[model samples]
Target chain A: MRIAFTSVGTNWDAQIDPRFGRTAFLVLFNEETAQLEAVDNSGVQADAHGAGTAMAQRIYELHPDVLITGNGPGDTASKALKNLHMRIYVEAHNMSLKEAYEKYKKQELTAL
Target chain B: MTNSGIFKLAIASGKGGTGKTLLSTNLADYLARKQAVLLADLDVEEPNDALFFHAENKVITPQYKMIPDWQSDRCTLCGDCTRQCKFHAVIRLGEFITVFNELCHSCYACSDLCPEQALPMKPYRMGETRHQILNGLQLIESRLDVGQEQAVPLIHATQKYICELESKPAIQILDCPPGTSCPVVAAVDGADLVLLVTEPTPFGLNDLKLAVETMRQIDKAFAVVINRQGMGDDAVENWCKSENITVAARIPYDRQLAEQYAAAKLAWCDNTALEEALEELALFIQQKQVQYA
Candidate 1:
């Protein structure tokens, strides 16, 4: 499964960005390949309004099977991503990317 | 004032409850007795001008702005509309093309540039413009529908409606939304003269400067009106004097005025102090009409 998480930086140790919409970097992890991909989200940050929807759109394009972020997506973004075949887990705030991934493996994260 | 053409006057403020509506309502009421007047409460988010008057024979017109609706079959998945939208209102991922109404500016840039004609502009109801005669004053109140985020479209629609209405040779007083933002710009952009109302407090002075700067930036001839003259320090008046901005009128601090205002009654009749201030504002408008004419 390709799991996507909002992160403050691209590295594995980088802390998770609590905000889903205006997150700094979107880090994608492929569990089988053990590979990581980071997409810069400056465009989402610069968006004057509807950053929630924009961030959701970006994640939709990535085709991630699971989304892990703090607070999950807001109402508007959640509605846009409603039909997506992905499990959204939230409350991973302040955790490093590696720690969050480890916690997800252990079924420690809660679903939104 | 020479009445060669319609004089569009706007009442604006940087802070909320600084007497923009007070000045607008009274000025429109006072002036309508002499000549034709159109009072537009352009504060669409919270329209309260109707509260001050017993308006009868209500006529409401629904206001709409165009928003792009996706036609999936016609779309080639070219991503043209998404790329062209500056507001990020439209986004396409896989087969789903989503349109966020709150983010749409209704510029038609995306819809017009779409090659496949997949995105067509559709009228989305944002607000309502109500017209009524309030003691001979032509009162037009534009109110945004609940959950509508963008107010500029409704304000523009109200302005357009006002323009299309008959009686062009009157003084049009627009009670604008507070703050120097997009909605304020849209509301005041149509006015020839703008009356920026403020108090004499520090907070009032701070916002007054911003309001004044906005007026200058827009290149609209504007003057200041000091409400609650005796309450705050003289910073506002001193600043206006130093800046060479006209002090059109200063409404003295009167508890009676406040009491009447709270009860939805015009201070024009009950409070002589407030009445005189409105008179001064009326005079200033008359003089400005000639200048603008």
Candidate 2:
């Protein structure tokens, strides 16, 4: 199964947000091999209207079975995640990305 | 020019964690002592100002309309809606048409441009607002329901409650959300003055410039307030100097202030410098409003 993780609300890479533009991290992981590949939403700066949805679309295209991020599972993000058939997991403070993935592998992260 | 109308001030920054709420709410309390004030917390998502007042929230509801499910039998898949959509939210595949609700801005273009009569429009309950009284101030705030894409519509609805005020106060401070998005724009749109609160750090300076540009573009009068001033270098001050935006005040890093805010004790009187800064800001805004009038 293919898995993906997208960061919204706050960008861990830039660490600072301009608030005007879109910023999110998109990661793709393979459940069969545990290999991970991720990409930043390059179209973030171009978001003028429907920015949140634009970021959501990029994540949806990844088509992952599992998703991990800072936003809660109950946000508007769930709608986009649901489109891709992806399970959602909320990343609390102090939990690293690798640890989050490990928890997903162990069936610790539940579907939203 | 005699302080007759409401003095709308926006507390905003382009970035989060800039202490905009602390400055807006605490300052509101300081001014409310001698004058009537209306504190509008416009930050729908994660509004933390109420954490400072812990006031009882009365519900405020707003309604919205969106595209209703269309019948496929009458639809010919002419792709009129798809081509008309700038957001690319609507797609037509053979006989099936799917609407990406998240991508749609509720523009009504799809429904209006639909050649077939199959398209139906319906109302979607987007979100609701909650009003409360803190101290002597009427604190009105709105909360966007989870999964709601449109936050500005609900914010606009919250402002309707403010018009019912018996007498327009000398000061009305709006605690804006942390961003330069539509929600932030709605908060600062009709404001006469804006108080931008930011920290003294690279991230703070980086985001402040963007927010400043936005304010300038909108032609709104604004000043700067530096929170946690001594934590980092003087980049914020230098940037302010270069940008020509006046630094109205600076609040040092104080553990006591944090404790006070956490305890819901936003009213402050013992801090002389803090009191002086807010009072000065209030006077400055009043003077600016006079010029505009």
Candidate 3:
């Protein structure tokens, strides 16, 4: 299972960003590989329109099984992610990627 | 003045409520006495120019903009359409593609460039236009649907309708939307001259600079109008003078004018000062039009 976390930095200890669409970085953790890979989302942050949709497209292309963020995806982004049947977990704000991953493992986070 | 082309005068504002509609509708009515005038309310989002008019024979037409109609059956799952859409309106989701109509710019890049020919462009209702003739003036009001995100497409459609009208009036007045955005560009595009209405406040001056920059960038001939002359400082007039832009006319701040405007009455109808101001503006535009034509 691959878990995507909206993060401020590229590392596992990076604090999970509250914003899903405008997050600066996305940290992906693959259970099979036990590896953390970061995707830069800063470009979408400055998009004049549909920044969330662009980030959602990127997330969908990444094929993450689950997403963790402070808030849920917006309307357009929600529609894009619904196609992948990927569930999004929210209320991960103010936590590190590792803490969010641990909470996800224990089923403590809320599903968006 | 000899040219057969209509003199298009667009009344726009750097800031909202800087008297764009107050100026345009009155100007159109003022000009309509002598010759037929076309008044286009290009403020698609919140059009209120028709409110003050006693319109007759109002005709409403639905407006549409093209968006990608995805045919999933031709399924090769090729991501060409997804990759080409700059707006991110289209995204591939395994067996299906999601197209957000709100985000679509209707640029036709995604549909035409699709290799599988699955994404075909189709008309999607975005807004409506109302055409009414009253007091020898033809009023065309374009209004965007509540949820519609883009205003430029509807403005273009309204302009197209205006172009196809039977009568080629010698004078056309456009009441444009606020700000110097793409919609504003679409509203004022191809206009012979533009009257940028701005007040004397610092916010008005700041946005006036932006509007002036946009006008200069687009190379459109424009003049400044000072609305509510005494309400704020004379910064706008000073800035226009420094930039060598013509201050066409100044409509003084008056309680009566505001009362008439708020009551949905033509402010120029009862106020002699406003009437003179609008007439002065009309004459100024006629001279400017002559210089341009």
Candidate 4:
């Protein structure tokens, strides 16, 4: 299974692309191969819609089975993610990027 | 004295990158020297005043409800709300009526048009209004919940805090949120004067005209302040001259002032000339209030 997380920075690594204003982040994870990769999506697009497109493209790129965030359950951006066959997990509060995978392991995250 | 209480002055612009915050804070700081000033930051979505002032903060909780609190038993599934909604915020399929709360404009048309009266509007908590004391000035601010789309409710709540001020000053400077939307209207509704901040760029000129038209439609008193004055073309001044709106103040481009601002220092501290200009603006607003009186 593959997963992704949206955070303030690009990922836990804190790397960001400087082209477009670096304001948001996207991280990808894999369960089968235990591979994790995180990339900055701020440079990929502009505005909220652009952020949605960037997430969709990441799903396409990683073919993630799950995606997670602190919020954004029914927002337009999250709806776009649903279009890509990616399940969404709206966490209750702030959890670290590493802890998200642990929550997934404990089945605390919702599939949708 | 005919209620010469320095009326709340809302400084707004229709677009981003305008000097709305810069001008508002400076004006408030300047007015504080003579009178007690309350600077309301109604732009809850992106409250940057604290970013500029970095002081202790207080929060004011905002509460607002949305329309169409659906009763599943009474709902006929006629899809009336989905049909009437201009924003496509509602959808009725089969036995369920789904609502995307963020997209809702709270127009109440959906609930009013429902036949069975199944849809009842419910009061929902939206965001919070906050106050921060920065450098001896009362900074009234509002922060909309990260995902909440109801900015108007918080903006209105911000006004309530402004009304609670112990002593009204000769001037109340309001740093309004960007854009000429519902939130902007709520911010500028009761202001006696509006100082529109703008620049000479094409984008600034374009949005300034939109803001001016909004003010005209609402029949409010207003003037323009050209910021970063010398960098952009002269079209901003020309547009003001053609529209017969007063160009109240012009702030020249000074990299040193910009650097000082970034370093969290006062912009007018080193520039005595700029300080004198802002004082003249205070005097100008005083005269305008008397003229209207």
Q: Pick the candidate with the highest DockQ.
A: 1
Question: Which regions in candidate 3 have their CA more than 4 angstroms from the true location?
Answer: A43-47, A105-108, B1-3
lDDT for each of the candidates?
Answer: 0.87, 0.69, 0.87, 0.71
- lDDT value, residue A101 of candidate 3: 87
Q: Comparing only chain A of model 4 with the true chain A, what is the TM-score?
A: 0.66
Whichever of 1 and 2 has more lDDT, that candidate is 1
Which of the two, 2 or 4, has more lDDT? 4
Task: Point out where model 1 deviates above 4 Å.
Answer: B1-4
Better of 1 and 4 by TM-score: 1
How close is every model to the real structure, measured as TM-score? 0.96, 0.69, 0.95, 0.66
Q: Candidate 4 clashing pairs?
A: B6-B170, B60-B129, B65-B124, B69-B120
Per-model DockQ against the true two-chain complex: 0.70, 0.10, 0.65, 0.03
RMSD each, Å: 1.7, 9.4, 1.9, 12.0
Error of 1 at A83 (Å): 0.6
User: Residue B30's C-alpha lDDT in candidate 1?
Assistant: 79
Clashing pairs in 2: B60-B129
What global local distance difference test value does model 2 have?
0.69
Give the lowest summed-lDDT range of ten residues in model 1 chain A. A42-51
Chain B only: TM-score of model 2: 0.87
List each model's interface RMSD: 1.4, 5.0, 1.5, 9.3
**Residue pairs whose backbone atoms clash in candidate 3:** none
Q: What is each model's TM-score for chain A? A: 0.96, 0.64, 0.95, 0.66
